[model samples]
Target chain A: MHVTPGQPLMVCEHCDAVYRRRILARREVAHCTRCGAILERHQWLSLDKQFALIVAAGIVFIIANVEPIVQVSLGSSNATTTLWGAAIAMWNDQSQVVAVLAALTLFFFPLTQILTFGWLLAFARRGERAPGFRQAMVMVHYVRPWSMIEVFMLGTLVAVVKASSYFKVVPGAGIWSFGVLTLLITVFASHDPRQLWHKTVGSNE
Target chain B: MTGVVTARERGLVGCHVCGLVSRAKHVPPGAMCPRCHAPLHRRKTNSLTRTWALLIAAALLYLPANLLPIMRTVSLGNVDDNTILSGVIELWRNDSWDLAIIVFVASIVVPMMKFLVLGTLLVSVQRKSRWALKQRARFYRLVELVGYWSMLDVFVVALLSALVHFQVLSRVEPKPGVIYFGLVVVLTMLASMSFDPRLIWDRKETDD
Candidate 1:
């Protein structure tokens, strides 16, 4: 780890261990010498690549929202529900808390995060700072934990399997869209998001 | 090891928001990071108190979350009510052991482990044991990673309730227990976030 002149210092978020920031080659990672939390990583995706993934996820998000998540058939009658319809049905069931929770986790937070990323990247791509960059970054951190898309996907699969024992169930286009959205979002997250703090204007480094 | 220095000893606080290392002592009241304009604090305020409160609330709710029925299935005049545990058994009895294990771990095992691990970390930090510091830090990370998976069961209940919506043939309805279970998961998640792992490294001595 060769530190450059006027090198910036970084303190581990997991531990308080401080170290001078160093230049790393592509695909290299810097681990905290203390508690072993990752300090930095050379992400595989460039800004354009990540931006593309974000856009693709945004499109898939729409499809996931609009299409039916699953279709159930019982004798002569059949039913299909989208994520929005499900949340509304949940609300109609009189459990406002669960309804809101379902709405926020499965729909609202992910949408907000995507919009925030779009706003942040619009400016960051040009070597500038996004308006409300601080709030945006904080939202990203907080919302990432609560979004729960992949978890929702797993839940759908489990629900399908459990429902299969009782009746005819079919996973729908929305489930496929959700699957794709999960991969795109995962890909974006795997590329360390903190790198944005370094790339934008007013960078400490 | 003897040569190691911390931001605290150097009177510097790295910006928790933007990673800018700046002097701590000289900053004016309500100082914000110059780069991102985030308010700077050496440590998160009321970390332990808040974590304990939330964890305890979650523990209290864990009872109803388990004891009462999470969801009920009504089909052809027959009703089957299942709690978190019984739901897993229902899945298993139906011969889906893989899903049974997944639900068992995520819904049941994960939250319990969080309570135990987080409770231990809080006690250890208060006592300042200075033992296995590295492992404690890793434990906190693990808690954060697995904390959200507890929501899996909640979603399963919601989707199941939403999909099987028919009067005569079959229908799924979330019971009051599902609400308590949802609260338990959310509370534990907040508890884990309220915890600040850096506290594990703080010492009372003049120097390490």
Candidate 2:
């Protein structure tokens, strides 16, 4: 509970009750006394494991973008599109705003989040803080809610079922990769950035 | 025993991002929190008006979202255009009861409820009605959380348009209505974000 110059003191976001901040043991979580909200979550996974997961996620993300996500055949004509193509198609068809929104939520923001996490984690692993470590962490938090890939997947499932009545729809390699990427992103995003920041600052106290 | 004092009673406000507490008077517009370097606001400025504007825009878009075709499917030279309601009905007719319910709730029920709940919250807050204060706060939380679920319909349309393409046999394309529908979802989500839940408690002490 010692208050140091650089150490952050916390208040409950929901209730505004001030409290001293402390690093918790693995699997430990600090809860707000007034509102019962999670203030911090410290999990047991070391930095390396999280970094490996991020690398795996980045690879999967690449595959998702490169491969065709779905293939459909109706009588004599068939069409296939990658994730990027889906948004671009909309853009070409005059729905410019929706297209841009789709691109940002589906691709750009998520990519930014992944890249930021990769940079921060890489620096943290070497016990060196990145120049923009704080800003990157903040960006991750802001960008997280906008990444709607999993929701898009759910929509895809519904769309596939609806389309099945008219013609044949086959899932593609991109679909598989997209699914895997979604899970990986969720796992990595769920880990608290505060704990990661603490790890990067090191045990030099 | 001392009386229970609320945070607002102490003139304190907490930063949502970093949980930093400071005197509300000290946090002017564009001021950053000392601890987290995040922008500090006593209350989100113009929260009510901004939320109202966004919600009204969503309401106007809701009509087109439901009335016009969301997707057009062409199969063997036969064209079928389905609006949100028609699409739900088509799912029902096809015996996909589960999916039909899900689409109906996500696309139709949720947005309508969001508008109603948000409207009621605005009215209550404006009038400073003390009735159901806790419930109103909880309701706002629910709206904030589930606001994005309405995007389910937009995603479905986008994915279908991308996937269901066959040169002459069949093709699925997004209709103009889907654009409006997507706009509606985004607007409502923004409205939810613009609302300051802390205001629910603020007026209580002031009005009394």
Candidate 3:
């Protein structure tokens, strides 16, 4: 039952509810009585286990990028496209702005998030502060909202369903990897990235 | 509830990025968070004006996003321009009621709700209305929660457009409306981000 206390006080970002910080027991979560926003939590897993999840997500992300997301077969001449291939295909097809938007939300932002968290965890593993820790933490916040990997996954499913009627569309390996990556990322979200700032708790990993 | 103290009341500012509380009696405006380097502020600066600006832009684009054709399909040389609502109807007519509803809600219902809920929040905060502060706080969270889903349509358009490029059988291309719809999603998200929910409680705290 090892645990580390965070700052002496905490404030709810969503509702401005403040509380005297509590040392949470393992798997326990404290919610703001005022607005019911989560104030703090004792994460279910330590940093090491969480870092492994992020690494798995990273590998899955690469597979999602490289493999074909959708394969179209019409009379033996089939076309298969990966996520990157889709974005590049769109780029060359005259809708460049939409292409960039698709690429950024689906690919670039998630990659940055995985790499940033991975970097932070590597330093935390050794009980040493990561370089540019402040910038990295801030980047996590800004990037969280924009990284719509799960949204992409859902939208991709929707597209696949809608397109199958008109074409011989088969869901490819990339789509399944995207589903797995979405689940891994959701697990990552449950940990609350800000918890990484607690040096004592982080060192417990 | 009677004697509760906020972080601000004790001269402590919480780092918005990391949630770390710090004494902030003499720090300059826009002081960076000591732990995370995010700018610490009592409240988001000009939250209302910025929110209103983005909301107005989104509102302006919403019409075109829904009216103009978002996708063009050429089947055997017959061209068809499909707007968002029409796309939903096409899906419905094609017997995909679930996908139709999903697209309808994500692309249409979600943004309209953001504009209305956010507009209400902004006006309520500006009017210093003490009505339903807790519910309003929840609404702010709801706004943030649903904002990203609005991008569903844009991604749908991008993916479908990326596919369906067959030379002779059929071709689907993204039209002007998707870009506008995409911009609307982005703007509303920004507006939601800029409008600080803390303002909903400012008036009540000061009355004490």
Per-residue CA lDDT of model 2 for A1-205, tens digit only, reads 1123564666555444456678788778898554445667776667888889988988898888899888777666667788788788777767767788889988898789778888888888887777776677678778877888777777777877887786688988988887898788777766876666456563322
What level of docking quality does candidate 1 show?
A: medium
Docking class of 2: acceptable
* Winner by DockQ between candidate 3 and candidate 1: 1
Give one digit per residue, the lDDT tens place, for model 1 in A166-190: 7799889999999999998888888
Q: Against the native chain B, what TM-score does each candidate's chain B reach?
A: 0.93, 0.92, 0.94
Residues B38-84, candidate 1: write the lDDT tens digits.
77766766789999999999999999999999899999999989999
Residue A18's lDDT within candidate 1 is 83
Q: What is the interface RMSD of each candidate, in Å?
A: 4.1, 3.9, 5.0
TM per candidate comes to 0.94, 0.87, 0.93
lDDT of 3 at B159: 81
Best by TM-score: 1
Error of 1 at A7 (Å): 2.7
* Poorest lDDT segment (10 consecutive residues) of candidate 1 chain A: A1-10
- Rank all candidate structures by their lDDT, best first, as comma-separated numbers: 1, 3, 2
Model 3 chain B poorest ten-residue lDDT run? B199-208
Best of the two (1, 2) by lDDT: 1
Q: How many backbone clashes does candidate 1 have?
A: 0
